[model samples]
Target: MTAIVEGRSANRVVAAAAASIAVAMVGMAYAAVPLYRLFCQVTGFGGTTQRALAPASAPLAQRIGVRFDANVAPGLGWTFKPVLTTVSPRIGEQTLVSYTATNNTDRPITGTATFNVTPESAGQYFNKIQCFCFTEQTLQPGQAVDMPVVFFIDPAILKDKQARRISEITLSYTF
Candidate 1:
């Protein structure tokens, strides 16, 4: 009888351990997304850009043509576009650009923006001081708003062999 009780206790312990492990695994899976995003933001992995606290003190003499592009997802019922089509900026100079989003539908709609820079290799050097991406925006019917993005192309781009030849950088955003 003692042996039988011990065997049953052992089985319970094993079952409890397995349950704990399964819960831990699920928790890790949920944590992985934000942690991976943090890693990407820091490393600029996969053409993901970074955020900066301040702009570079001095800009490089070389000029880079930056084009802005914006789009609203289908069924979003919103019109979105960059206010400025293009701007030539010296590396390290802070530039402020704006995008306008208008809701044409009769009901309020919310959207979040995601963005990337072209020439994939140049993403690491593109930094934004302030951006509206990732923030939830809600607009009522016939409502329009201008969102601004403050950014600078890191002067370090000039030092990168792969990015130095890039004359044009396109910032594209999708809602």
Candidate 2:
């Protein structure tokens, strides 16, 4: 008679099930990175972290009032007409911004957008609560849509006191 293994109960089916469960659990653990990133982006729970197209130099303060600019680049057949609202928070407040995108191309176009905050000093405090950047945007010929973003600055920023040194903030968008 063959000697039975003591630990596994000599059952092949039981071993197979255990192996599958282990594999499945390992797979889920590996997927945690992308899953958590998706959750952050969708809910804006953490400080909005996005890959910067290129390293941006720390921003310089102009006057006491910070001046922010919006730079947008639409896809080959798309057009962007941004409608930005003025933000004058006490350096620790939330603001809303809106943009209008139009499909001027003869053919339908679908693409995504990515963005960054310049003047590393400002980026630390800038937070995007709601945005469409880095998301797939589908536009049909002559189709236009309004995109909105909600953002807020951490109150801790003011505590830095150095934050007051920052005047203008720029929120640029590139498609």
Candidate 3:
């Protein structure tokens, strides 16, 4: 009886350990994409720099809708907009993009923006050489400023078999 009780307790311990590991693994899998994005934004690996996707590409058979979205946190009161945008670019060169940010709330809003080149597959070639989107902007209430982002496409983009049909990309922001 005593041996059986000990075996059961050991089994339960092992089962609990397994359960914990499974849960942690699931959480990690769920977080992988976002964590990768954070890593890219922090370290512009493979031309993955912070900037809006500039519109300068050849037109598609039909227009693929690309939308720009802006977000400002409650404590950070600011209004942001897309001033310059992009859609097409030569494989080796970059596209330019611009945005205007205004301090709407009474206090100054200072925050950093982390952006991704969605169809993130495009991120592999989107290079932001000079981009205001990478830096934090501090605006006094009622203060409005224009931000510029200069970027280019990686030469490799032209060679990417998976990316061949992709022409238009949208860059969005959240504070």
Q: Best candidate, TM-score-wise? A: 1
TM-score of each: 0.90, 0.57, 0.60
Worst 10 residues of 2 by lDDT: 51-60
- Which residue pairs show backbone clashes in model 1? none
Q: What is each predicted model's overall lDDT from 0 to 1?
A: 0.91, 0.61, 0.66
Model 2: per-residue Cα lDDT at residue 145: 93
Clash numbers, per candidate: 0, 5, 12
The CA lDDT at 98 in model 1 is 96
Tell how far residue 96 is off in model 3, in angstroms: 2.8
Over the stretch 111-148, how does candidate 3's per-residue lDDT look in tens digits?
88856666666666566677666677788889998887
| TM-score quality measure for candidate 1 | 0.90
Candidate 1 has an lDDT of 0.91
Off by over 4 Å in 1: none
Off by over 4 Å in 2: 1-75
